[model samples]
Target chain A: MDIDTLSEKIVAGDRRALSRAITLIESSRADHRDQAAQLMERLKGAGRQAIRIGLSGTPGVGKSTFIESFGKMLTGQGLRVAVLAVDPSSARSGGSILGDKTRMEELSRDPNAFIRPSPSQSHLGGVARRTREAVAVCEAAGFDVVLIETVGVGQSETVVAEMSDLFILLIAPAGGDELQGVKRGIMEIADIILINKADGDLKPAATRTCSDYSGALRLLRKRPQDPQGFPKAMMVSALERDGLQKSWEEMTALTEWRKENGHFASRREAQARYWFEQEVRQGLLAKLDTPSAREAMQSFAAKVAEGGITPTVAAQELLQGLRD
Target chain B: MDIDTLSEKIVAGDRRALSRAITLIESSRADHRDQAAQLMERLKGAGRQAIRIGLSGTPGVGKSTFIESFGKMLTGQGLRVAVLAVDPSSARSGGSILGDKTRMEELSRDPNAFIRPSPSQSHLGGVARRTREAVAVCEAAGFDVVLIETVGVGQSETVVAEMSDLFILLIAPAGGDELQGVKRGIMEIADIILINKADGDLKPAATRTCSDYSGALRLLRKRPQDPQGFPKAMMVSALERDGLQKSWEEMTALTEWRKENGHFASRREAQARYWFEQEVRQGLLAKLDTPSAREAMQSFAAKVAEGGITPTVAAQELLQGLRD
Candidate 1:
């Protein structure tokens, strides 16, 4: 239970200890948090060796299948692979499918591969707190490659991008008009574009779709820093296992290039800084529940509704009320 | 400038007075807002007769063109139309394109049509405020139909649906995979699905896409609490004027049906209630900027970052600190 003992167990590659450590950190419990902090401090120098890659797509883009194929490929080459699949929690249940293990059964059964799925719980930050904590756990467990699979290319996926060394965006063969509707917010965040399900009768259409996307992508200005590559597009098929190796190779190449070029380290540092700021914002917002603050808010709102004043003015009045 | 005088002029079809009143309400200036409140009270019963329609799509869906064509159709039939197009504010400039009038030259020139583009400012609710106020202005100026075109159909579009009686979702003829990626959140909100750009070589593809969407849509359960005759789908072209009449007919049918069933009046009442609630939330959050709250927040955050506490615990500590 002590930090040093738990840290040793985790570093010795005990999966249970690693999982428990993540849970402790993720818990809102006071004592567990103290234990988690102590554990993270002891294991501070234990992580940071894994190649973290974030993969995202709209649902049904074969995200699970793609991870399975890519995991199998990595393990086949004698690389230790760990996957953290982040599923947004069901709004009704506040729980995830937690089906990544079943979806990646072969790799899950492999002694060299580990898979974990974390529920988002409606939090927009990419990778659940448990999942990010689990990545450090995985790294401490000596996994060389950590794959973070997130659902959709929205706020949740952007979280993955922040924590990842490489970010992959997956799409299908979309019609011209459909492609145009793709939000620039997501597109701007994407580092690599993969058009999945590019096999069978849809091959020609997929090819056309790829060309169309590639053409549109070209019109998008490059990242102010990158001179050569700006979200390179490729065609792949998770079912057919086609282009899986090629995509993996490209990912590895990008990681290596970024790491060597200083972008990787700097990117990780930036992510760490962002994580800190966001945590503070979330923390402060959660604190406005004091009795006087809450009381003043209620009275002010009642008055505003009674047509005594406007919202902006009422807000200022409430703040002054709090001060008194 | 008095409420009674302004109200009389607005009802007498004074366009400038209506525009100025809306601008005043949307203004943050304290005096302007007080005047706006007076204006709101006076005009409360004057602008409820217009048919409010919400149109949303991902960007590049030719939203402006569609609105222009739809406005033209209404004006051609001697019906007055007003459009409020919401444009995304560029983060860099903190300004919007506000180009709806430019894009809608034909409709703008028409005597019976009015077009206004509101900037999506720092506050999501602010954009919405301007929009609702603009709609009231149009209604007071005798426009029978008020069309609200959203900035885009991701998260922001949800606000538009809260104000409009009818919600129309525009999508392109998507192939199989992209179809799966469309958020079910969007589908659930859509009262009518309009497949835009169904023309030329895309005609057959569009028809096939329509069938696919129709089939997929059938799998969804009937929306609870929604009136019957919701979720109609049709193909349309803003450029070619294809299916424009059918789309308009559906809107009219829904409006008439809702009016007959008493849902129309209730919907407007619900919208006003919802707007007040949203304003309260924004107003209360603004109170969190008080110096005492800010200081307590910083100190608690330091504790969280130092690993002596968790965010939730830190939150409680801040609230407790406020009491001191």
Candidate 2:
């Protein structure tokens, strides 16, 4: 369909149209970008009145199970929810392949819930940009909540934390050392720490782990008004849906608190500012291979590589050439 | 000293002079940057003369102890060594006040060894930039080897990986679950995996963890070749200096292999290209806050926050106002 038709459908709150429009934006074709930008401009006023939550955990911490249970709980409360599971993309292919559909199979079938697994590009910052853009599409489609799942390692956790109003970190029952390692980074940013797989013999261990994290977090100064009202460590059995309701309630309360305060509005504004900077950076980099610059850089690069000159000097020379 | 004087001293292999020059480069003062860049240009001809190695691990995983033992091993072989430790900066003060001098008490006294712990900036990329710049200074000072000590968690590992030729990921004796958590993202990039504290009762556990990681790594493609050689996994008792010699020998072997194959030269060239892109991106972003742009953007931002306009349209409007 044409850009005008898609833009109209997206503004009218059509989910399929919104999804199609996002796919167009994700396209790398030069012409597609202009079309996508225009469509986005037309649908600019279709703002998401939805709450966005970010969830992070190391691989195999049952992030899928927790989300499935939590998504079900939200649906039970009659809230229309959307899930954006971000899969790490291959550096070579630059495509995510959207592998999360199989993990959230149950949630995907819910009519009130929309599940979209987008490929996380090579960099966390790139994935975050796409995810944020997709969330806007999801919001315009009238979803009440958008839950973003990040591949919880390296900078992805920070990227997710920056974009979401509420951030939850999932952990399992590994003792003190595991607790120590977690304390080093992502755990500090967590508004809520959910100790998953707290069933059978692991229940007691999960309780102990929760207490350890709670104590560890106390040493970390209170994160002045987290999206959530307070830092909480809760044990949840996703298989049995035990404590799922409590987790949902906490998430809801965090959303409510962020909205009532000025954080929700401020964070969105900050995210937009971040996106603007990223886009400019990306745009200029993409244009580095433009004919005139490429011709000037190539000859200078060859000389530097041959040991006739150093890279730093070569760069300065190239900048002078570009300026001239 | 003036830029030309500092550059001459560093190129003349004055270690103390080189250290002071690096401090000037890492300084945030605007004038210091101009001097540092000029110094870097002068020293470009003295590039890639040292083997750059990265060591990462959890705090208690004996990173400092391993480095001490390892540094002694290299110095014993008549090699002058320099260690650049990236210390976590205070989030509030943005200054690094870590007592690394106290941490490496013995090594600090070694005339053949130089240990400097630079405070990590708010951005991991910034730390990498300064460390790369420092490496150039150290190499020009006639240090045969450079070791970069990075904190294990978050983006620190990735940043360290990019800047070093050989990356050693230090893991402790946590079983399957912990291994499962780290098998992706940053850990997957390791060229060498060392299970530290492999002594006493922990020996068997350390051996098992090494084997487990080796098995998991088999699922990934072979570790990237260092200009020196391919990476490996080993068990080491940093306290006892057990396996320290083997690790050192392997590191040396890899460095030789890289030089002979010409991979070392090509890789450094690529790294220079990467750093150039990062500098341009950051430079452009700093310009985004020019007085007129900031004022116009702020007023447009207020409208976006009040829901009178969307961020995309508001940004365009602000840019237009600034241009006008």
Model 2 chain A: weakest 10-residue lDDT segment is: A279-288
In model 2, the Cα lDDT at residue A187 comes to 63
What is the docking quality class of candidate 2?
Answer: incorrect
Candidate 1 residue pairs in clash (backbone atoms < 3 Å):
A126-A159
**How many Å off is the CA of B204 in candidate 2?**
4.7
**What is the lDDT, from 0 to 100, of the residue B251 in candidate 2?**
70
What tier of docking accuracy does candidate 1 attain? incorrect
Model 1 CA lDDT for position B184:
67
DockQ of each: 0.09, 0.15
lDDT of 2 by residue, A160-256 (tens): 7776878888888877656745735676678888999999988988989988888767767665567433678888988888988888788778767
lDDT of 2 at A24: 80
Number of the top DockQ candidate: 2
TM-score of chain A of each: 0.88, 0.87
Compute each candidate's TM-score over C-alphas.
Answer: 0.68, 0.68
